[model samples]
Target: MKKPIKNLGKKLKPCPFCGRKMVFHKEIRINKYGKQVTYQYYLHEDYDIYHDESCILDEIDMPFTIGAGDANPDTGYIGEYAEDWNRREG
Candidate 1:
């Protein structure tokens, strides 16, 4: 069951160093028992988001991170990650 991802039009802040955006994942949907279900999704528009990448590749000091949704919803608060990233800009 491969998880699916969709672009939510959520603008990703440009990297302070490279001014580049990150990557988006892909997903596969299916109907089970006449119910639309998402089998372990990796990305959601308003649910858990997962991302851990450095603004400057290989630069651990300057990095942006988001919550991952695996067995559980580790990060489900929308706009929270962005706030954290922008806050760290200082």
Candidate 2:
């Protein structure tokens, strides 16, 4: 038998500190009733809280980071971060 579809509505919130808008970036798929379904999701607001930053694309260092959902391998480190490592001023 087939199952009823579920509505997946807005799942993002704004940052409390910086008031920046957030969006759904990640989700988990699971098996339910012999069918594939979406499970727990990490909201963007929660990400901002944990990251301790307001802007999602702000400066950050992940090479020496020690967290599960903290490192962003796509964009690498921030420009200012690289300058700081080189001990050079902008």
Which of the numbered candidates is closest to the native, going by highest lDDT?
Answer: 1
Error of 2 at 52 (Å): 3.0
Which stretches in model 1 have alpha-carbon errors above 4 Å? 1-6, 24-57, 61-64, 68-79, 86-90
lDDT (Cα, tens digit) per residue for candidate 2, span 7-85: 1102223333355433223233556567665322223333333465535334343212111133232443222322232
Superposed by TM-score, candidate 1 places the C-alpha of residue 74 at a distance from the truth, in angstroms, of: 16
Q: Give the distance in Å from residue 14's predicted Cα in candidate 2 to where it truly belongs.
A: 4.1
**Residue-level error in angstroms, candidate 2, position 58:** 18
Q: Write down the worst ten-residue block by lDDT for model 1.
A: 41-50
Q: What clash count goes with each model?
A: 1, 0
Report the lDDT of model 2 for residue 80: 37
Measured by TM-score, the strongest candidate is: 1
